[model samples]
Structure formats: structure tokens, C-alpha cells
Target: MNAPAPLEIIAMAFSLTTLRVDGSPTPALCVDDRYWALADIAPEVLQPEPSRGLMNVFGHWEHSEPLLVAAAERLASAPPLPAPHSLEDVLTPLQYPRKLVLTGANYYDHMRGDAGHSDWDKESKAPLFFLKPPTTTLVGPGRTVRYPEQTAKLDYEIELALVIGRKARHLTLADAMDHVAGYTVAVDLSARDWQRDPRHLVKFDLFGGKVFDDSCPLGPGIVPARYVDHDDLRLRFWLNGELKQDAHTRDMIWSIPEQLVAITEHLTLEPGDIVSTGTPAGVGLATGQWMCPGDLMEAEITGLGRLTVEITK
Candidate 1:
């Protein structure tokens, strides 16, 4: 008998989301508002790659990216695979990242206008970062962000989230892009009132404000980097249909490679770890508006996708 047939390899691009099918994580390819089960569309490709969920796909992105893309290219013309589901049925692209790193005030307008720090000089200063308790902070699109009772000052921030594709440590700014796999829209929800230490034992409590339930609403899906313009993508946010923060990646104080260099200097960044670049100006504290219960938040990064998360008590 013949041993087996080799799988055909080709690279295309599609946004990768996940669905809860029969109690297991199933990959779904998001084509606009519709989502098709990846297993149904490309069983041959899933055979070698992890079909479990989007998180696992990052581990094998080198081979998976192309294979999945080749399969996704036909989505527009292909017949229904059993049938596709609406965006409401799928989960965020990733949930359990090993680390959820966030940049603090990387956007120029955010720093000078919203954060009220005009003296920050990127040329002479290092980048700032904060880590969220991801397991609790992360929620999928269409999910609800529970407004914690601890703080009355809940806020919304829209940022470009980067999905790491390879293990990287001490990489130069020029080589940093090679390790990034994809991009997603992440809302860095915050509790402006709780962001400080009441006890005054420490400088601030970034977690106290940011670690509430559903603090980080990430993804409609992750679009592979090859499919997007990394340097000049637009980042927009909407609160209850009112556009709040509208800016571009060009406004960021530190470049993606700079952010990675800042992070990798402390520890190694592995595949599946998340790095949310930073939010633009127009946070509640800046605009004199705040997120309330029942408010809907939408975050969008150009060429990536939009993520909608409802706020609730």
C-alpha cells in the first residue's frame, strides 16, 4: 500500500476565529460577517495543524498560515459547508494567552492629551508596560464586560493587539516584525478610579483598575500580518455608536518593534502571548465621558477586524 499523500502547501490569508462546537474548541474562518468551520472547509489542512482553536494555530503559524490562507481564498466562491454561522456564534480568536502584555501611553495624543503628561520624551525615555491577569481579563467579541462595583469610573480604550508567532528574546527593532504572526482589535477596559493605590504603598494599581471581569475584550478574529499594513493601520473606537478614539498606528510613540524590544528585554515572548500596543486618546477620563452598564464598545484596527463587547453589571 502507498504510505500516504503529502499535503499541498500554499499561503493565503483569513481572519481566524473560534467556535464552541460540541464542547470542544473548533476553528472558524471569518469571511466578513459569516464564519465557516475550518475543519469543514479544510480538513486536509487541519490534519497537520491544530484544529482545536486559534491559540494552537499560532504555534504552527509558519505552515498553518499559508495552508489556511489557501483554503480561505475560496470562501467567497465555495458552497456552504453544512452552513456558516453569524459573527454572534464565534468566540474571540484567542482566550488563554500565556501572557497579556499592554503598553502604557504609547500613543502620542493619548499621552499629551488624555494622560496629561506633556513631558514624556520617547527619544530619552523607555516604553512603559503593564500585565493583565489574562484568564479573567480576556473575553470574546459579542461577550459582555461586567462592570465591577468596586469603581465608578469604568473606561474604554482601543488598541491594536499583536499575536506573537515565534519565541523571541533580545531581538533588534529591525528583526522584531519577523516574530509577529497576526493582529487583532483589543479594548483595554479600565477602572479609572481604582487605578491608584488607596494605601499609598505603591505608585499606582494598574491591575486594580484593569483586572476586573472582562477587562480585555479581544478579537473578532486575528488577521495574519501578511494581509495588513503594520505601520499605518487605523485604530478606531465607538461607544454606543458614537465614535470616540479615531487614530492611526502612525500616532504611536513607540513602534511595534520598539514595544517588543522593551518587552523582550525582561523575558522571552513565546508564541500565543499577546501584546496590545496601546490606546489612543479619547478615553473616558480624557473625553469627560465614562462607560456605563448596557453600553456597547466596538474596537477596530484597519485591515484586521472589529470587536464588539457589551458592558453590563
Candidate 2:
């Protein structure tokens, strides 16, 4: 249970994450630029009540936050142990998101830039959302994303994803932020060639075009809600080390609060439910530039850190 040496520490920030070592998942607190196994730094947080790992921690977040934050703060003065595993041991911060929900076309520039919905207006429109099967779609940072055999068009959309810490429903704009657990970076991988299901005469099918194996890559780790300015942060995406998408969270067509309010009105937002804010103006669909095997993708959101995923056949 020893953590890495104290020489390398992430100054001024800490985030909670789940790591897989020896093929078993365990919760860890990352501070001072190091990942300290929770069992080593603090064992109380891992009580069986909430189950082990980050997934269940969300359900108990309100009560657990103080302990986690305090433990991270004290670790600096306490002895540091060797990191249980190297950075590659990092897994999706949320081992199992209860629901992986995302807002689509929530950015004005993204809509207009592609020339698809240039006239998209916030005052008159509602946010569009979709879901990906959590277990199959979410891969951790540095993991490999499979280029599905079904399509010729593959793309990346960098987005700032919001993690909900509290179970909420019918939330109002005024207090919506209170329910947020924290933030993380998400890469929405896409396949543009999923042609319409001709029998149904549907022009766009979310399932065919968006939902596929390894389509969503989330986390380097989750930065707590109080740790950073969620609305003003920057988002960037790179395809094979070339920056393609660059935008700010402030540019979204509808604010995060608005999206949360609308969605919560219809369904419950439970602990560990990920609500990904939409992507910005740099997807490859408009230019017909498709991704091929052996490509690499890096997605980053300021404060949350960057996650790298390799593309392979």
C-alpha cells in the first residue's frame, strides 16, 4: 500500500481516481503529482458500505469528501509510499458510471462551423442528449480504442464532462451546481459513415452513428467541483499529436446548469452519473477527413489533465 515518493507531487490540486493493479480495482487519492493507494493513505474511505473504488464513492461523496480532502492534505506531511503502479495503472476514474449521458450539439460554433445548423440559437432551442452503454463504451486514459469494422469515418470530439455527485431530480438553475461532484475530460469518438436505416427513413441515427465499442474515453481523473472553474476552462483535442479542436467551455450554446435542469426534470441524476457537455467546432465529419488505424488521440480539459488513447484496428 505504499505510495510514490513525495518528490513528485501535483502542487495545489488533488483528484480522486480508481486504479487497477494486479487486475483488481482499488480507489486511490492523487495529490502532490502522485497516485497514493487509498488503502495506504486512508483506509476509512474504503469501508465496505459504499463498496470499494470510485463508482460507489459518489453515492457517499457528501460524507466522504471531507475525509478524502483531509487525507490528501495530511499526506503531504506524512510519509509517501511508492506509487502502486505506474501511470498506466490508471483506469477510468469512475469504474462504473451509473449512466453515461451526453449532450449533443450544445455548442453554437460546433453547429455552425460544420455548416449543419449554423443558425442554432440558444433562446429558442433545447439541449439534445444521448447515452452510451457505460460498460462497453468507456475506456481509460492510455487505453486502445478499437476502430470498428462497421464504418469508414472515425473522428474525435473533445468535451468537458460534468460528474454528478448527488442524486437529484427537478433541479433548478439556481442551485444546480451544488449537485455537481466534479469535472473530467471526455473524448467522444464518432463514426460518420453510419448511414441511415433506410427502412425507417431516418436521416440521423444516434445509435448507428455514435454508439459503438470504445466510443467514449473518459478520465485521467476527476477534479473536484471546488478545485477549478468549470465554466471558463479550455478544451482541446488532438489527432495523432496534431491539435484539431480548440475551444472554451464558455462557448456552449446552453450553459451546464441549463442542460442539467432540463435533463433532471425528466429523469433522475444519480451518483456517478456522467453528464458530458457537448463538443466544440472541430470534428472531422465536415471535411471528409476520416481516421485510420494506428492514429492517436489526446483530449484535454484545463485542470483535469489530458488522457491519451491509441487507435488500432
Candidate 3:
């Protein structure tokens, strides 16, 4: 397979009408332009169901810069995009998403203990998958990650997330990349107690624990699929400014092509569908320490940019 070009980009922005702490409408731009308003755009430009307002912004950067300027002009003239209400207020332009699929233990070193090799051939016979509800998404940067009752050990997994560009079923590896619209940073927040439990064979509590309200903090921005060399990009996570998880995309046991091919065989992935490639090791659960109320979580991928969120009760 050839490397993807950088021009096929989709860009999304984190447009804020207010500062996160005071709730006062303070205009700012984190990814692109500060004045970008989702509500002012054509619905079709932001279409394809099951889409996250913010994720869609990040994934569809092709017209984003121009769109941002147009939104600012509209805001200056019309009733004005209302002051953001917890970031969700601007989501009117993004299509609502349904399911979020994530890969587990896809990293090379993560598979070394049992798989012996860095690729799937040396790893398990099949890809490991997990799901998170769309409602779990939290768009604002400073929003709190509530520590759910009964679960004392909470961890964070930093991942590169891809949004599906079109509906695809049984897509071949050769055509898999075509279905990708763009990429963004995702933090797969987990509750270690439920995640590591051996008694529950179905992992019901795992989803409940990890996919509860405000658990998934994504964004800051989305870089178009064209901006990254997916196979060789670098990803890293920092807790309180200290580097914790670091790895290259090349280390995945099951590459994106293989995973996309496998998933399309079982599920019809639609545009705006999110597939979070698994995180590298060094998560709190694996290291024996978990995140608490005051920790700051940050992640960055080369070309895709960076995202940081402060954990709060």
C-alpha cells in the first residue's frame, strides 16, 4: 500500500463562546479559527448520521477554514450563535452518532508478553474490540471526568481515532483507507475494577464503567486524514505534563487496514462512524496507579496535533 497524501484533509475546530472556568462567553479558537460556529453552516456539509459535532469538525477540515470565516460573518450579522453552553450548544451542525468502536491491545509491545511478535500474525488470531456509547462524549477541554461510585481505580488510554467517511460493508484491505474521513485524539477513560475483573465474561460493567456520562473527552481539533502518514505517525500521552504513553503507529499488531477490513465484515460502518485505534501500554491500570480528581491528561500525535483535559470530580 502507498502512503496517503497530506492534501486529503478534513479539519474541525473547537470554537468557544466562553471560557471554560467562568462560563463567560470569551471567544477563542483552539484548533483553527476562534469564530467558527457550527450552527451557521449547511446541514449537508456536516451530514452523515451518528456524527459527533466536535468530532465532525475535526474530521472535516477541507472546507473548515472558509467555513469558519463564513460562520463569523453570519454570527456578526444574525441572531448570533448563542454563547456556548458546555460546548454541546454548538453541536447542532454535527450529525448524531450511534456506536463508537475501539480496538484493544493493538500495540506491538502490548502484544509482546503473549503474542511474541509485533504484528497480528504473531499476536491473537482476531482483533480485540470494545464499544462506548455516543452519549459518553464530552467536548470541552476542562470538563470534569466524574469518578463513578463503586469504582476506585480509573485509567486513561490515549488513542488516535478515525471517523468513517462512508457506509462500507465487507470492505477489502485494499479499499479500506478510502472509507476514512479523518482523525482525532481520543482518551478511552476506563475504570480498572471492572476492566480487569475475571468473573464477568461479557464485560457489561466494563462498558458501564468506562462509557458512562462525560467519560470520553475528545477534541481540541481534528486533522484531515490527508495530513497524517497513518502508518508511521507518533503518539504520546502525558499525565500532569509528564510523558507516560509513547509509541509509533507502525507498532500496531493489527494495522488500520486489517482492522477496518475485519470490522466491515461484521458491521456496516457509516460516515461519521468512529473507530479508535487501541492505545499503547503505560496506562494507569497496567502501571498500578490510577487517575484522581486533579490530574491533567494530555495526548498528541504527529500531524494530528494535541489535546489536553483536566480531570475533575
Candidate 4:
């Protein structure tokens, strides 16, 4: 097979009320507002390189220096991004995509030495999965993740999310990568207490804790697939500025190619369909640190981009 062509890094921006540097809330831009669009300034400022994950953008201290400092200065001085429309007003023009399929426990190390192994066995035999409603999407930054009354043990999982470029069904591993349009940072917020209910069993509990409103916080930017080296990108997560989860994409037991093949066997993956590859271990629950109201969660992938959210009561 030939090497895939290099992808141009696409710029995506999120409007938020608060800046990561400061905790004060600012106005969030509406999803439909075109003012949210920002220039892909990373290239002109920094030397271009094809690296997968958020680091592809944030890794360049020199290039990102301007934006980061500008944001910081704004936080210290200027007002926040304008929230021009009401929530309902903004959601109206926003095109909500359909169908988001997530792969569970796709990392090899995560399935090692526990009930997770048995779960992996079942999944490998018949890949464990779940669906997230599009309405759950929080497209921009500075948005507060509300602590659902249904769950007290909210957790964060940072995973590389792929956006399908075209319709695909029954595709072979060899042709799988061709269907991906771009990549972004996805935080799969899991409610451990609700998800681990023995009464429902693991399979049914998969969606219980994970499918809440604003559970999936994506974007800030979307890097086209051509720019990412999917086989070996690094992913990391932090809570309140402390490192928690860290792993390489190459560690996935089931590669993207294999995952695409497995998923398409029964269902068609259409354009705008999203696939969140599994996250590595070290989540809040796994570490005995559950997310509470007022906690900050930040996630980053090497080539994709950084995504941060605040948990609210």
C-alpha cells in the first residue's frame, strides 16, 4: 500500500467564558457564529511537521507562544470571547452530526490482569462498544461540564477521535484509513459508579455513565488525518494541572485499520460519523480520584489539539 498523503492542518476554535490561565468565567461564542473561526496560524509561525495528536500544534512553544501569551494577557486584561447568542439560538444553526461509535478497552495494557481482560476477550470475540448522542457534544472550550445527579463518580478519559470523511461500509483494513477526514481531541467523560452497576452488567452499563449531556468535549481544533502519524501518537490527560494518564497510540491492541474493519462489518460509517478510539488507563476512577464539581480536566493528543473543561455543580 502507498503512504497516505500529508494533510493540511485545519484550524478550529472554541469560544469560552474562562481562560485556562484564570478561573473567571467569560462569554462563550455560539457554535453557529462565524466569528469563532480562527486562522491556522501554527504553520506560518512554526515550521510544519506531520505529527499525530495535539502536540503537533501545542508542542511548538515558539509558535504557540503568541497565542498562549495573547490568551493569558487577555485573561489578565481583556474580556472573554463574546457570547452573542442564547444556547437555543446558537444550537439552531449548528449542524449536529449523527451516530458516534466508541471502542472500549482497545488498549492492550488496559486489558491486562483483571476483569477487563475477560471483557476484552468478549470484545475481541465481539468488540465491546457504545453510542453517544450528538446532542452530547460540547464543541467549544471554557464550557462547564455539569455533574449529573445520576453520577457522583465522574471520570475523564482522553482518546484520539476520528471524523469520518465519507461513507464507508464493509471496508477492509487496507482501505480503512482512506475514510478518515481528520482528528481531534475527545474527552470521554465516564461515570464509574453508574457504569459499574453489577445489576445491569458491564455491557449495559457501558452507555449508562457515558451518554450524558456534554459528556463528549471535542475540538479547539481539528487536524486533518494526513498530518497525523496515527500509528505512534502520544496522548495525555491532566487534572488540575497534574499529570494522570499517558500513553502512545501505537499501544492500541486493535489498530485503527483493524478497528475500522471491525466496526464496518455490520454498520455503515457515514460522513460526519465519529469514532473515539479507546483511551489508556489512569482515569480518575482507576486512580481513586473521581472528578467533583469545580475540577478542571485537560486533554491533549500529539497531532490533534488541546481540550480543557471545567466541572460544575
State the C-alpha lDDT per candidate. 0.79, 0.80, 0.63, 0.62
Cα lDDT over the full model 2: 0.80
By lDDT, the best candidate is 2
TM-score of each candidate structure, all chains considered together: 0.89, 0.91, 0.73, 0.69
For candidate 3, lDDT tens digit of each residue in 269-297? 87667788988877776577888888888
Which digits, one per residue and each the tens of the lDDT, describe model 4 over residues 1-313?
A: 0124533122222221211212322212212232221122223322353221122222343344355324432332333344434322222111345777888877766666222454454343656678888766554455457788798788888888887766789999789998886677788888887788777854448768788887887765555465567887889999999998889998887888888898999899876577889888787655677888888888888755567777777
TM-score winner between candidates 2 and 3:
2
* Tens digits of lDDT, candidate 1, 268-295: 9988889999988988987668778889
Stretches of candidate 3 above 4 Å error?
1-35, 38-95, 113-124, 137-139, 201-205
lDDT computed for candidate 1? 0.79
Highest-TM-score candidate: 2
Look at candidate 1 and tell me the lDDT of residue 108: 85
The number of clashing residue pairs in each candidate reads 2, 10, 13, 14
Each candidate: RMSD to true structure?
6.3, 4.7, 6.0, 10.5
lDDT at position 46, candidate 1:
54
lDDT sort, best first: 2, 1, 3, 4
What is the alpha-carbon lDDT of model 3 when measured against the actual structure?
Answer: 0.63
